[model samples]
Target: MTILNGLKILDFCSLLPGPLATMMFADLGAEVIHIESNRRVDLMRIMPPYDEEKESYIHQHLNRSKKSLQLNLKSEEGIEIVKKLVKDYDIIIEGFRPGVMKRLGIDYDTLREINPRLIYCAITGYGQTGPYATRPGHDNNYLSVGGVLNHSRLKDKKPVAMGIQIADIAGGTMHAAIGILAAALHREKSGEGKFIDVSMTDAMFAMNALYGTQYLGSGRPPQPEEEILNGGTFYDYYRTKDGRYFSVGSLEPQFRKLLCEALEIPELIDSTFNDSSYTQQRFKEAVTDAFCTKTFDQWLEIFNEDFHGCVEPVLTFDEACNHPQIQARNMLVDVKKSDGSTQRQIGTALKISGVEPTYQYVGAKMGAHTEEILKTYGYNQKEIEKLKANGVLI
Candidate 1:
């Protein structure tokens, strides 16, 4: 059976963090109802690289298996509708600045009075209570303030922007999902709900898992090219003869032995264990030179043949998506479009044994499910038309 078969979620999030979190819950079989706004329209709807269906590719991928209700939050009728939804929907995911929900008169304190089982999650850049709580920030700003961007860079060079939204996805999406699930579990036990205040910056700061502890204990700040896994040792990326890169993470002695043997450099195998800076530099240089002797495809073939060290070519996104492992694991799925055709999209990342993820439909247009949802909540056709005519329902 599905894990969250009967769980209901009212999603009031946009962009990445909170939307992706609710998408995960929807993947787990929860009934996710998305609250959309046509007046303020989410930018994801207009981002570049739209599909043939006119919706953005990312919007389709992140918002699959959910229902959308477009409503004007500025109207009292819309606020009353949201309060009515709170009576039955147990979870609410919001991505706004600290006091936006409170100003809307639908904060956790207000909603919990409606249903004590409500699990409200607020995803923000900073946090609900901090000096920078209400500050306008984005993923990069959060990563910088949380100390990740400082150390995740070239030794003396400027920090480059990451290819993905690490703070938005890892900090906000992942942490919000975990917090909501944990609150659901707690509510199951105690018959009470919770208010989860998720700060992307705070999550990033807490993600300084290993190096942060070292700094706290040793009183020395972590710098780029100093940590073992952060380009200090031979555990790094090497360029191939064909300009492609290979990740070399043979940190353990056994793996290092395999790597050195594969490169036909037995002399450097023992030197790999040495902690001296000169020895490490020499080892890194030799490994770099050895990797330069082969092309990207040649290295992959050689590694596949017999080499078992932690070395592999860095595949591009398309290449990784089409790889045999990813294909075998069913990472790509065919989501149903409105016209009964299917569009290939990334499937749910979760891998529960018996619970299969259902992709009902692609992301809906603005207010696509407004009348359908309102009908279920006791609003008849006349009332729904009146609300729509009065600019409450978009």
Candidate 2:
């Protein structure tokens, strides 16, 4: 059985973070009912990484293993239908801005009246409370406000956007999922529901915890490209012989010695180069020269012979899929499509002993389960037809 086999989740979220969070739950076997809008499909349906036969990879990845029901929350009858479902669900996740859900009359307070045991998680860019809570912002704005951008800026260069939506995924969606899980467990013991207010900005601040701690303690500001982990030649990326790259994190003396020995650089044997100024110049040049002498394959071979934990070859998406270590860890899984085709998909990163994770369905079509959901909510055939005709359900 899946971990969340008996749990019912009402996923009233969209975009990346909230959907991905609840998708993870659905993947683990939760009965997640994705409450979409008949007025508009989720933006991901038309976004990038689309497949010719199916929807975009964003929709495929985030909506897999769940059921969808398109219902317009703007209509009175539609809100009533959602209220009925709330009575049966254990958790509800909404990613709308603050006051939007309440305006629809399906907010936590209204639902708590029907089912006090429900765990309601509200995920937003700045949270439900704060001066910027009402402001419309995206992942970029959240990261900027939460000080995450400071860590990502290049030396003397403007801060660049990250490859992934760290604020959305890491901060908002992930924390909302965790909060819901925690609230669910607590409700099991307390017989009371709870509200989880997750802010993307607040969540992103966690990325700078260690630096924040040091900054607070030493009265030193966290400068761009200067922190030990963020900067320093010992723990950074370097281009290799073929213009490909590898990363080294030989922060400790022993690991640094291993790196120097592997590259046959005796000049870096002393601690003088350990200084920030000297290390940034001499160590980077030395490492760059050594890497330039050999191809990425040759460097990989050298690292394979050594047992140090500080060195690793940087991998592209394709390379990462076929990497021996990743393959051994079962990080990638082959998913069979309905048309007798297959695609390589990422598997769950969590590895719990004695508990296997499973995904039994691909992403379904929009509003694929509208009739079924209405029936489950006690709506008869004729009543559902009326709602469908009125544009409440499609």
Q: Indicate which candidate wins on TM-score.
A: 1
Q: What does the lDDT come to for candidate 2?
A: 0.82
Clashes by residue pair, model 2: none
Query: What do the candidate models score in CA lDDT, each in turn?
Result: 0.89, 0.82
Q: How many times do residue backbones clash in model 2?
A: 0
After superposition, candidate 2 runs with Cα above 4 Å error:
272-276, 305-307, 336-342
Each model's TM-score, in the order given?
0.98, 0.94
Looking at candidate 2, the ten consecutive residues that score lowest on lDDT are 271-280
**Clash counts for all predictions:** 0, 0
By TM-score, how accurate is candidate 2? 0.94
Taking all chains together, the TM-score of candidate 1 against the true structure is: 0.98
